[model samples]
Target: MNTLPKPAMRPARPEFSSGPCAKRPGWNPENLSNAVLGRSHRSKIGKARLKEAIDRTREVLGVPDDYLVGIVPGSDTGAVEMALWSMLGPRPVQLLAFESFGKDWVTDVTKQLKLDAEVLDAPYGKLPDLTKVRKDADLVFTWNGTTSGVRVPNADFIAADREGVTICDATSAAFAQDLDWAKLDVVTFSWQKALGGEAAHGVLVLSPRAVARLESYTPAWPMPKLFRMTKGGKVTLDLFEGATINTPSMLAVEDAVDALKWAASIGGFTEMKRRADANLAVLEAWVAKTPWVAFLAEDAATRSNTSVCLKVVDPRIAGLSADAQADFAKKLASVLEKEGVALDVGGYRDAPPGLRIWCGATVETSDLDALTPWLDWAFASTLDALQAA
Candidate 1:
């Protein structure tokens, strides 16, 4: 056999990115192609599967008996927009911002709907000042910022009985971390993120307060068919059962059900938390002694286990500039992905220049650990290339 050289190392799977994250090992897309395809979403079999997905979601999330789960279109974005549009006009809003998605909601609330609110904002790497939340204001916050890779430590900051409701975009935090249902009014997420489910739908969970808002107050404008949570001026419990707001991809529902079932078989939230903890340990170890690397979050307790962001620390490397750092990370991700070692490591475009790695529950810690050294190699390669050029 003729050999030129041996490869340094081969990764077991792609490195994790936050959303549209690395798929579960041995996930065959064709497995879904063979799923209950071409069935009417309202058919008996289809309804059973949809209901099962919702039930499993409720079970795994430990959702309170007073809450309801609805399957809706447009993934997490839709779930969140529906909540914002329906629930905002009646209350003074406290919109919190720490990262890009939060900023997006701010734009929607301020510039788009032109709503009145108190904004509790912070820079990317820090937590929002929760102490300033108006007790009389409805609050909007993301439990985790997948962009900046920072998260609120807990919901303990909220009052036990604030008059205004809390609407949370917990897309990245749901299932991977513990969520206190008592403190939440409307919580929304997409299956595509941590659950490794397909796109096209969102899971919207609402507390009794949110439902009561529906029963009491109507939006000042005509509600779209997709945004209308009520039917004939009454809350439609069937939407929480099996009737989705719009037509859903049966295949996606099956895929989501499979992911939920997998979560259940491995022991619901405990297994998810275990996987997330293991991944975070790997990330923490990697960030500790890498010479030029440090966590973006200043505080360890508030650092996100799901979306971990790292910044280059060596003063010598600071000369490269933040934009350069961002470009370098994108190059690193591209190179690794081309070699099949990793995929999607660059920070979100709207975030500060840094590398963001996902440590969500569905990702294998062994795969994450195996990819860390490759990051060093990637950085060194970048430095050498820049010097040579």
Candidate 2:
């Protein structure tokens, strides 16, 4: 048996799944000490904490003053579903699906909602034809395809004066990418993503247009309390000011506040994005030199800086059957996990056989640099071990 020498450096924090990503650099359980755990969310103190979370999120993200930000039930999925169910029937819809999440949304619109939806789909590592999208129709798309590691390079595809609203599921892109608020009508994300806060809640942002749609046009389907943003045929403005439609965990709210404050302290969105970019740079450099691996996203311009997916390019691994390739990828990830160098680096089950490394802002660049060498070691070891077996 050939024994591979272990790498000297390891990431201090090895919690790198895309959702519930690595927490802020110095996060500890005690950070939630001030949570109003045993009180009503509508109570004055609890409301204040919730409002603080909303206010800080708006400020840090530079959301336009006209836009309304609300804390909604469910995580990113909940927020996205709420928008899709409430706002799609009034107009024709154009849906883009390049990854699993986007594909899920497509199913929701085409099968569930049963709306007049034109779905534009791409393969695992590519983008759909944006040119075919109709400006007159409502557009639904993911800002970043977490599963495929592909992202829309810019919002240029969205017209400045479209007739319908643009609903965006930006769960993975929220903090790391620059959102064009003027070009978007509905944007949704969860606290568990780029900000690295606790989950069970989602943040939904609505443009004035989105609000108008809710208030003026009611959906044909019955709107549950969970997805209801309007009351008595009017937009419930209180939801934007800390009045949640459902009970939320005060502990999670406090953690979100902590994450927002940490974001502001580190120079806000720009600094957070810079940190993620740096992490990606470290991995990109390594990928350029490594012959055995290549980015899953074929276009460099569309590659994601956060959910960085890489495919096994070595002939030995890449040439294996699909099931074998998937198994091999799993074994490689397990090798790193057992070595304590990385964790949760496996590709999404529905995605192509590859490794998905979360390079979100909370992840330290030094850790990524340390982990890269370990990746090389793990690959060599996995190949050697598999051949022997």
Candidate 3:
């Protein structure tokens, strides 16, 4: 019997799950000490804190002056649903779905909303042909697919003179990528992703066009209070001013403010994007040298800088059955977990059998650098364990 030699370096923080990603480098429990807990969210101080969250988000993201940003219920999902249910039925919808979250939106529009929709879907690692998308139809898509690690390279495919609105789910892309605000009418994200804030609340940004669509159109179906953003055929401007549609957690609100302040302290979006890019570069360098791993996204342009998904390319592992490959990937993750080198690096449950590493802004590149050798060690260790069995 031989003992596997453990890697010398370890990540200072091992909280790498994609959604509730690693918190900002210096985050501490004390950051939430000023939270207005045990108080009414509608109160003056609470509302001010919520408004600060919205205002800081706008300032950090460089959102245009006329664009309205609001805090909504249900995190990113809530914000997206609110937009879809409110404004989708007015025009023909074209949904581009390449991953699980995008596919979920397709299901929502086609099944739940029952709108006149054209769903353009592709397999896990690929994107739908953007050139083929109808220019006149309302567009809905994820800017970055967390599960697939495929991100739309840019907004060039969208027509500049298109008649309808473009709704974007940018939960994982917001701070990590450049968003063409002129091309997107609606953008939604949660605090949990790139900002590394607490979840439960979603940030919804609306262009003038999106506001017009909401005020002009009414859905045939009933809009739950949770999904309601309009009142009496008018977009509620109060929502943008920190008047939430429902009760919100002031504690979460304060945590979000802390995260946003951290973002601003570090040079805002450019710094965030740079950090994510560097983190992904760490994996890209390793993958380029290691023949065993390949990016799940076939095209380099479409590969995500946030959730970096990788597939096993080594013939010894790739030759196995799909279930066996899945098991192998799980074993690789378990080995790293047991060694306390990494956590939650497994592929999404519904995604292809592989590993998904989060490279969001909140993660330190040095941590990723330390984790890389551990990944190689874990893979080799797993292979040995399999052979011994």
Best candidate, lDDT-wise?
2
lDDT of 3 by residue, 1-389 (tens): 33447778899887778988888889999999999998888889888998899899999999999999999999999999999888887678999999999999998998988776998889999999998877789999999999999999999999888899999999999999999999999999999999888889899999999998888888888889988888788988999998999999888888889999999999999999999999999999999998888999989899999999999988989999999999999999888788777888899999999899999999999999999888888888888888799
Better of 2 and 3 by lDDT: 2
TM-score of each: 0.95, 0.99, 0.98
- Largest TM-score belongs to which candidate? 2
lDDT value, residue 155 of candidate 1: 90
Full-model lDDT for every candidate:
0.83, 0.93, 0.91
lDDT of 1 by residue, 1-389 (tens): 21223246656777577778766656777656645678888888888888999999998888988799989999999999999988888889989899999988998888877887778888988988788887788999999888888888899888897899899999999988888889999999999888988887999999989988888888877678888888776789999989887889988888888888788888898889889889999989878777878888878888888888887776656777776767766776676677677778787888877688888888888888778877777766666666666
RMSD values for the candidates in order, in angstroms, are 3.1, 1.0, 1.3
Give model 1's TM-score versus the native structure.
Answer: 0.95
* C-alpha lDDT (0 to 100) for residue 279 of candidate 2: 90
Candidate ranking under lDDT, highest first, comes to: 2, 3, 1
Question: lDDT value for candidate 3?
Answer: 0.91
Query: Which 10 consecutive positions of candidate 3 have the poorest summed lDDT?
Result: 1-10
Give the candidate order by descending TM-score.
2, 3, 1
| Pairs with steric clashes in candidate 3 | none
